[model samples]
Target: MNISVIGCGYVGTTTALMFCELGYQVVAVEKDSKKLAMLQQGKLPFHEPGIDSLLIKHLHRGSLVFTGDIEEGIAHSKIIYITVGTPSLPDGSSDLSFIEEVSRQIGAAQNDYKAVVIKSTVPLGTVDKVREWIGKAQKRPLPVDLVVNPEFLREGSALYDTMHPDRIVIGSDNPEAAETVKQLFHSMSCPIIVTDCNTAQLIKYTANAFLATKISFINEIGRVCDAYGANIEEVASGVGLDHRIGPHFLRAGIGWGGSCFPKDIAALINMGNNNGINLLIVQSAQQVNQDQIGYFIDRLEGELHGLNNKTVSIYGISFKPETDDIRESPALKVIAEVQRRGGTVAAYDPMVFDKHPELKLPGVRVARNMEDAWKGSDCFFLITEWDQFSKIDWGQVMQEMRTPLVLDGRNVLDARKLRSLGFRYYGIGRKTGIIHE
Candidate 1:
């Protein structure tokens, strides 16, 4: 199938490239001239592992075309996937202006029976509104079918997620249109769930909310385990071994942050508020997530008498490993808070420094290497669990630091090893009575 993927953002770019790899002719549309120029030159505006090679190869193969002309894209393709951004508004509702505008364009541009699939994350009843917008824009009754197909791609592992999704959800009132959309992913071995538009929308929001809840639930339990002298790792392992609650998002850390969880949860809460319902559990989960950094800071302060004039080293900056995305990263919040308390901060990340040079953290220095980050620092905070961080020489770090302190924000380090190396180790929800206020 010839597919046109609109808006070459994170989701759009990945989907377009994956479709091209699957032997489909793809037209990737981007409105920005600069982005189009970059893509045309085999360059991506963002960093995604393995996608760069595929993008260059497909662009060379002539299977993929990047352009700014929406009409050309709409005219060339039988299936149009609107993968545009629906960012959160100030009031926590999804701003559907982009999708609405694109829908009108698709309606005006289509001359034949076309299946318009929504691959963007939108609110409930959005497809109905899209249909209305498209109907009014069209000159006459053109055969256009609206399908809701939300994406479940993670930032770091987006390429893998795109090819091997856990499930393919197709939500459309038109069964024929839904089946037609299913054939797009026929190469992949996965379960396909066909339902109405609302169910599909809720499924995306609910899935993220539940994962957020799991993180917060484990973190809250970690807090209790901290008060007592219990190991959160052992407790979480025991709970996860039950087979009922498999260990996926059970790793307790600073909190959940990315392009998806925070915005989706807020929009869902706003959704509940508009309908005269209060989602208490989801609300509490959000609240607990918000408290994670501060909670960790309190523990850190308890470890050191205070953070005044202390030089702290941060191990990672990206929210999670393998991507340079620092959107809503706990490390940024921690850096700001630590600086507010009169501490100097330095950070080292494999991807963030060089790729994301525009990343501005007030009163923080981007370090060159692990040694440079640890050199003369009072303590180290392991914010993101990059694989390289686990392999650092703790003995060398202890010798280089002004104070041999290690605060495991993600708890990915070996606490026992750090302690044996004569370094003061403090992990979130780990019971080590080494620090007393």
Candidate 2:
């Protein structure tokens, strides 16, 4: 299959590389000169585990070609996948201006019959809008059946999710186009759900909304545990053992922060509002998630009396571990709030600040190492549960910090052992010795 993938961010880049790996001749299109130049030199614009080698392999194999020409990209392939950004607006609605602009470009560039795939997450009936744009721009109707193919990828494990997806969904009014897409995915043996375009779009939003609800549900429970002096980790473990509620994303954390969950949840809220339907549970979950950051800060301040003129060291920055993505990262929000309260902040992450080179937080210093982050700090904040954090020698951290204060926002650290090591430990919704006001 010859394919053109527009937009080369995390989702588009990973999908382009995967299709090329599957032996498709891929023409990757990007408007960013720097990113296009990097791709031409076999360099990825961002950090994705194992993507560098995959890009290099496909470039050497002559299966992947990166470019910025809309005509060349359109003329070279029959299947065009539109993958762009849909940022959230101030009132939690999706700002799909980027996707709309790309639709205009794609409509103008269409020369023949092609499969236009919607790989970017958009509001419902967006595929119809793409078709409408094609009609408006081309004047003479372009022969393109818009397919709603939403991506359900975890940030850290995107490649794995692409290869081992729970299901492959293709939504279109044209049955032939739907089956053609199914046949194109010949390498993957995942369950295929062929449906109409609206259902496909809704499926993606509903999935993310449910997962976000699960996370907020647990975090809200953590709030209750904090008030009653109960341990959340233990309660979650016993509850999750019932085989009904799975253990994934069930742990109480600062909040759910990434590109997908926040945007999609808000989009669904907007959808309900437009149709005059009230979603109380989803709305409450959003509220609970918003509160998590403030709750974590309160815990830290309670432990140390006051954050004014205090030195705090933060361990991780990325929203989750194993990937360098900072979109809607909780660490950024928490650090910002702490500094707003007159505290000095320092942070060290295994990855980040590369693609986002201008990530400057006022009154914050990026640390060089674990020792440098912990040196003489009054308290330590664990925002993301990176694997290396659990393996650290708490004794060394306890020995180096100005005060042996540890706030485990992710609940990844052992509270008992840290307490025995002469460190005051705090976990979200856990009954630690240090109580928040």
User: lDDT: which candidate is best?
Assistant: 1
Q: Total clashing residue pairs per candidate?
A: 0, 0
Q: Give the per-residue Cα lDDT of candidate 2 at 148.
A: 76
Residue 278 in candidate 2, Cα distance off native in Å = 1.5
How much is the lDDT of residue 44 in candidate 1?
Answer: 81
Winner by TM-score: 2
Tens-digit per-residue lDDT, 157-195, candidate 2: 888888788998889899999988878788888998999
* Residue 269 in model 1: lDDT: 95
RMSD of each: 2.0, 2.0
Clashing pairs in 1: none
Residue-wise lDDT of candidate 1 within 53-82, one digit each (tens)?
999999999999998999999988889999
Model 2 stretches astray by more than 4 angstroms: 433-437
Evaluate model 1: give its TM-score: 0.95
